[model samples]
Target: MEAPGGPGAPPMWGPGRKMGFGAALGSRSKGWYTVADGNLSEVFFPFLDHVALHELRFFVSAAGAPPVDDSGDGQHSISWISPGVPAFRVETTHHEYRLTKDFFSDPEENAVLIAATFTPELPDLRLYMQASAHWEPGTDGNFGSVIDTHPPALLLQQQDIWICVVGPFSRANVGYFRSSDVHIDLTDADGHLTYTYDRAGPGNVSAGAEIGIRAGAFQLAIGFAHSRADAEEVARTALQKGAGAVRQAFERAWRAQPEIPPALGKVSGDDGMLARASFAFLHCLEDKSHAGAFIAAPAAPWGETNHDGNHVYHLVWPRDLCRIATALLDAGDSDAALRAFRHLQSQQRTDGGWHQNWTLDGTPHWQSTELDQIALPILLAWRLGVAGCLDHDPYPIMVRPAAQFIIREGPLTTLDRWEDAGGLSPSTLAACIAALIVAAEFAHDAGEHVAANHLRAVADYWNDRVEAWCSLPSGQYIRLGSDPDRRPTEGSTAPEFLELVRYGLRRPKDDRVLRSLQGVDTSLKVSLPAGPSWRRYAGDTYGEQSRLAGTDRRAGPALLFDGTSCGRAGANT
Candidate 1:
């Protein structure tokens, strides 16, 4: 696309590239941008220092205009809306900067260059600059500026690049500009400039520029920053001395990366429906990890606000942490998988349950109920086994106390219901019992018979209750102590039944239970290798699914029997 300017516009101000920033760097800086074949282009430039304050601008032709909307708070921003394509935009008021590339281009054969100029509208301050080749995210989850040795930082010289201080600006600021496999230089012709660059392997060379001067009209160049008669000569020297060898080395390193299949998973249909869904789930999984102890859905808490009108899902909850840890473990990030376990152990309540939700500071704000909290240790212990990380036999200490609390409080009795605050549901009691049973097994493995006995008693209480509440008409278990005056709705039973099935609790074989399970299976299935089937009974839908009536199907839902009941089919047997 053509750069934004009138016909025959004299090369606007700086550089010889007629395409301007629009062609080279794209108009916007936020989303994604490309230089080579669109497929080999994955570039991101996130400004750190002014991320929160400054606005990012992208100059796109009509063909590339992003979906525009006012960020509910009234700020103007464009949403890329399109999936997969690398789009660009800017962010204002950031503190640190970051760039990510997925080997879309060849560093040696192709060059990716970026340049920035600082012109102070007000003059009285000098821009202090520090730039590095690459920085990884800090332990605190923010990006850190640490120079890595494997990819060396590019050298900088001021002969060709003008590094003049236009004015003594009030604020001393730092800015960065980086390019891969390219020569970089800063000169003090019109103003001071700073440059950062890295090279992977030998091939084509590229250059980038970054300058921090009092916000004003300043001029900076890529190869030559100065306007001297010998500026080209100086620029060539800078390129040869500062960039050539580095570019060659970077090219070699870039090529060394094993070319495995792209991380993109399977796609279904012409529209790539499955691929889109997978991308969304994976993106959410990655971004959610950024929440520290929890995973926030990509839609955040905003899209699915809780009953309290707050964004509960925006913060990490116990359930999400468990799912995220499992996903991480599955993805081969064992270390990160363990972080959630440790976080859960650290947050355990004195009574052995975890709070429902917490803010980023780890402050518990919502209800500190039994169900949510109980799931924490249970999930942690389960993951320990799944991830092969529980060599120390930490399950008893991690899980027994919670189980004991449930046993002491009376199993199948609502200990605490966050949603109703005062009322208890049979399903809640069942879930608590199910968790305690798992905990009891862990206790038994640890030879903690006393804890095991207590858990066993809790399980007995729940089983007796389940037997009494079993409804032949529904073929599913009814919630104990549910008000007879209230009508049972699909929402009440589906989730509860699904949870019981998923967690390995025995359900009566009455037609109603069969019908209920079939109903759930039909509603939640997405296409997969085996067949369309119900999604797992996550807590959100557990309560509802549990109440449905059973139906006979020639083929039953895919049943994943927990170790305890892998062979058992009937409660009597």
Candidate 2:
């Protein structure tokens, strides 16, 4: 019988959202894996943009009881195996049993290894491994098969790309997702994978295996390659090397970099928060095929029910890249920051403005152009140039055109930093004014004094006129728009107003800036028990909302799993 969704249809957003990820050093690894709700989730291969495996989760059940997925039915927790590396140790607990998995990427191959241990050694306990494969960026139109090898493996393929799941299995089977998968049947009736199939179609497909946990432990590896044989070989070799050896190499590789300062090693309430942030940031740069092309996040935001399209956040934003470069500079990773600058140079459009976002290979994914993206790179060049990180000047090729692009088509942005609403924006203007001023410094270094003078002149003009262009009659900055008098009837406040002070166009203690902050806090602040947090804006609609009374989607009064806009509410940071 076909499943309720459809026969071999695409999978839903998540077993759960990504909690953390594990990737080896950028120089040695091409594979990255994420831990979500304590389950191995979203294995990316070759490139961070391509998701080869949707999930590889462990299930355990007594002989006649239904299986409990590590993701959904267990209490989950995760932590890095080391402070400096992205490798993770995830633990999930239940009344019946407990599972602990140490996840690490194989440094020498495109593969990930997990060493797992189950607790209490129950005699009737059976451990099953199930892998849902996507095989490409979007999770659709994939094929799966069971390979009868010595140790046995499951292979998923999409055109030329292949991914193999290698491990010790007493028996293996392949099946269509949800409808006829052995994993589902195991959960539905008995705790055994009895309804085994040999192959699944060119739709949502997965593979299942009954793994024998000897003394409460087992090992598995997920590997990727252009050919099926090579993929299996890579995984087999990784598993043969053992997770202990592979994990040591992974941690040692990351620790080879400069040590993080003791102050940054831990935070007061959230120990390891800063260190984990650094590791997560560096994880995005681990793509060997595209050095320094870091995606914003290795996640699929709002992915719970929205799985049909390729709207994941695993793409590069030049604005985010520039900020990351600045942070890298602060963290003493000059090499990574410089590499990012070079990658930005490669992605710069002929018109000099970058697309709103792009894939790691310099392919434009979204066609919109944000002025902040055009300006931020020039700012980065100036920072890098000032720090002597740039061996050669960037004026002629990068900074010059980028500065000119801003002058030609901006301080008025086609899209704001949020990729919403056009026209005058406080933050966009701040970026343009700052970028032109820095670009002027590069222009002078390049012996183009006239260009330098003109750039500074434009920056000064924007700096002086920003208040007139953005402030409402009451002195608060409007979230967006060209005219100050045309403020929206509903109150509006954005964190974007702080950019004027951040970019040095305004003083922190200035009366106007303080008034704007007051307005923002009064309008957007949510006083939670933990602390005060601000919403994106007064009328932001980015998070969960109630379903409308009659329509499939719209603003309404009842909260629903569907993220369709129901009403404006605080989706805080």
- Estimated TM-score for each candidate: 0.44, 0.90
lDDT of 1: 0.35
Cα deviation at 245, candidate 1, in Å, is 17
Model 1 ranges with Cα > 4 A deviation: 1-292, 298-312, 370-372, 408-430, 467-493, 507-510, 517-573
Per-residue alpha-carbon lDDT of candidate 2 for residues 342-429, written as tens digits (9 for 90 to 100): 9999998888878888898888889887898899998888888777899887889999999989999976787887775787888889
Instruction: Using lDDT, give the best candidate's number.
Output: 2
Q: Give one clash count per candidate, in the order shown.
A: 95, 3
Highest TM-score: which candidate? 2
lDDT values for all models: 0.35, 0.75
Model 2, position 358: C-alpha lDDT score: 87
**What C-alpha lDDT, on a 0 to 100 scale, does residue 335 get in candidate 2?**
86
- Which stretches of model 2 miss by more than 4 angstroms? 1-7, 11-16, 26-28, 120-123, 135-140, 261-273, 276-280, 484-491, 528-530, 546-573
Model 2 steric clash total? 3
RMSD vs true structure, all candidates: 18.2, 4.2
